[model samples]
Target: MYTFIISIILLVAGYFTYGKYIEKMFGVKEERATPAYVNQDGVDYLPMSSNKNSLIQLLNIAGVGPIFGPIMGALYGPVAFIWIVLGCIFAGAVHDYLTGMISIRNRGAHLPELAGKFLGKVMKHVVNAFAILLLILVGTVFVTSPASLLHNLMNGKVSLLIITLFIFGYYILATLLPIDKIIGRFYPIFGALLLVASLGVGGMLIIQQVPIPELTLANLHPDQMPIFPLLFLTITCGALSGFHATQTPIISRTTQTEKQGRKIFYGMMIAEGIIAMVWAAAAMSLFQGANGLNELLATGGTGLVVSEVAKVTLGAVVGTLAVLGVIVLPITSGDTAFRSARMIIADYIKLPQFSMKKRLLIAVPLFVISIALTQIDFNILWRYFSWANQATAAIALFVGAMYLFIARKNYWVALIPGAFILYTTTVYILNAEIGFRQSLNVSYVAGAVISVVLVILFFKAAQKSRAAELSLEVDISDYRNIAS
Candidate 1:
């Protein structure tokens, strides 16, 4: 219990201290115009209030990952709390803030464009393909869960096919419409429900004095899976997730100022960490122990655990509302996942999004692909999504590091975590069934070698980029002297 409370305090304190420090390091220019005003296309780049942007950003990235992931992470005992706090502070929030602010500086360019610009042109193509595929998978995977839940809630009065089609239809509308229309207006309410649900569960746990175990380094997994990469991957959104990179650019376009980046990007991630901490605590305390939680997970998965926890803690009426809030999570993220995909494609093709025809040109095929992907098994899609998601994060962190290095800021802020996640993701794929299926020791050695080579390459690229910028500045100075 003390661990959970201190962790929450640490996350909040991180915002005022580390969040502000990062903002300053990025050199926020208050007087400068933002993309929202400079590129007011009415479709994607529309000015929005910090409050609205915060809520929208919260819902955008706070999908079921935080809830489901942490619930699963609880199987690792209180050690999961350590990852939530440290990862959220050093890695997750930093990743989100840098990605969003960098996009804002680049006129709200999506991750692929930024990755290409900072990392390399090759990365641009790689990330473009990678991000689009991941978003589609996210959209498709999110669709099934919510549709099934809604179907269950309605007790099959509505067919699953109909629920899914309706969700896909809504995704189309949300994707094609202007940002302020459906998403901006509805998200605040959805965000409220999400907060209420999370806070309610957390509050009741404390009020009832649920005996949440104190923090420990024990690996309490019933299967005794190693905690290194799997735990990191298992609990992503609440800690550090690459998926947030794709979402951040969406809000990047709508931000009214550089200052709001802290609140909208960094602050919302902390809020998510809090949500994750709550769910983790609830799962740990309510389930009796790691063994009980594992048994429940094996039988019914996290969804059943969530329902049971909410009903038991918050009671029947509010529990139902809390579950609905959870339902809203994936729906909101799914819409934006499709929306982000549309924007990425539009940005890639250099198509103007102002025109409805142009928007459909990109959005139509994306949805078609997403629909087809729904036919694939959910577990298989998630396995790929999980790896792709972290890989994207590693790339984004490297982009942030490159940006910082070029700007001559403290690049280590991004570099250290970037390299660590890069190494972890590499190790994961190498050992997992999806990849080479190598032994863990082989994965560690190979992942270390790969990461070191990549870090060296990153430094070389940063040096080249820095030298290019320096040359341009010198040329400009000489031209000014000539003009004088």
Candidate 2:
């Protein structure tokens, strides 16, 4: 409990501190030469309404990854907290901020479009492929985890079919509703419920005398455990995430002020980190060892984990309410995932050029795939999804680094976070031994390979940008002479 509170405080404090630095360094409030970048007609580049942009940005970015990723990582014990805090700041937050700003500058272009503009067609296609795959994996995880939790809550009496119907209904509402209306109404309600549930669960745990696990850096079954998978889980959320890069442009297009990007992007990531900490603390407080934790999860699944924690803290009824809260939170997140997938596929097919019926046709298969995948074990899907997510993050960091160099040659400060992410993810890959000594389970290895290739492409783009700048300067001088 102490650790959770401290983690929240630290994350909030870090947001204000580091966020202010980004605000000052970037000067997002400065007037642009033209408002073309900020304002748009409708489909691709709609102007933001107001400060609510920040809230919308928060709602879009905060999701199940932060919650389940951290809880699952906590299997290694409390030390996992360190990775969550540091990685959120250095990797996740930085990638989000840069991606948002870049998107805003590029006339609300999505990441793939931006990649095509800056990195070239080949790279753009590659990024799009990676992004689509990452979203599928994320959607799969989101569906499976919550469904598993729902199953546990109903004591496995709830058939997968019923859960699927409920999720599809939620996704339909998420799609049909306006993004702003949904967020404006539900975010506060859901957030408040979560706060109450968290507090209630914590309070009940104290009253019920649930056994808190000992804090230790000691390894559990060191010989049996593979080093790679452990490291992969430890650094899961922090390093390179594919899903974040895709969402960055979505929020960027909705931002009112470029200045708000730092607060909305980094602040949300920090909030997610804190949420992860809370769940991790909850898990730690409720279970003793890995085996015990496994048994609890097997019995109640992740849903039971929350229910039992709440029951220990609040009482049976309130605990069940808390479990319900837990289920709703992820379901909300999954809805967004579904929405994002639809948007991506819509863009992929250029369905705006087609009728609305055609767009729905493209969207149906994607939703069906998500629903089918949801029936499986969420934890397994999350493991693979996290790896692909890191790969995208690495590419994004490379892109951000290039943007900084192109926009302001002296702005090396912007690269600090990127450098840290590269270093940590690299270390995580090199030191860890993944399952069967393969790279598939190791995000660092995957991220490193992708990062190296992107870095090469970035430098090539920078060189061409310099040449174009020089040519424009020469043409301007000639035009000035003609005017004189």
Score every model by TM-score: 0.96, 0.80
Superposed on all Cα atoms, the candidates' RMSDs to the truth, in angstroms, are 4.1, 6.2
lDDT of 2 by residue, 1-484 (tens): 4445555577778778876676566556433311223343343335554445554554455556555565666676656666677667666776787777776666555667666655567877887777777777776666666676787778879897788677777676665455555654676667666657755655555566555443354643233555443544444543235577777676665665655677678777776676666677667766766677778877756556666666766678877877776666666656666666666666665655234465467557877777677665666666556656665676676667666666664334445555444544454555434333435445566656765664566567777866665221001111121110
Which candidate number maximizes TM-score? 1
Q: Local distance difference test, per candidate?
A: 0.89, 0.61
Q: Which stretches of candidate 1 lie over 4 Å from their true place?
A: 217-223, 470-484
**Prediction 2 TM-score vs. true:** 0.80
Q: What lDDT score is found at residue 344 in candidate 1? A: 94
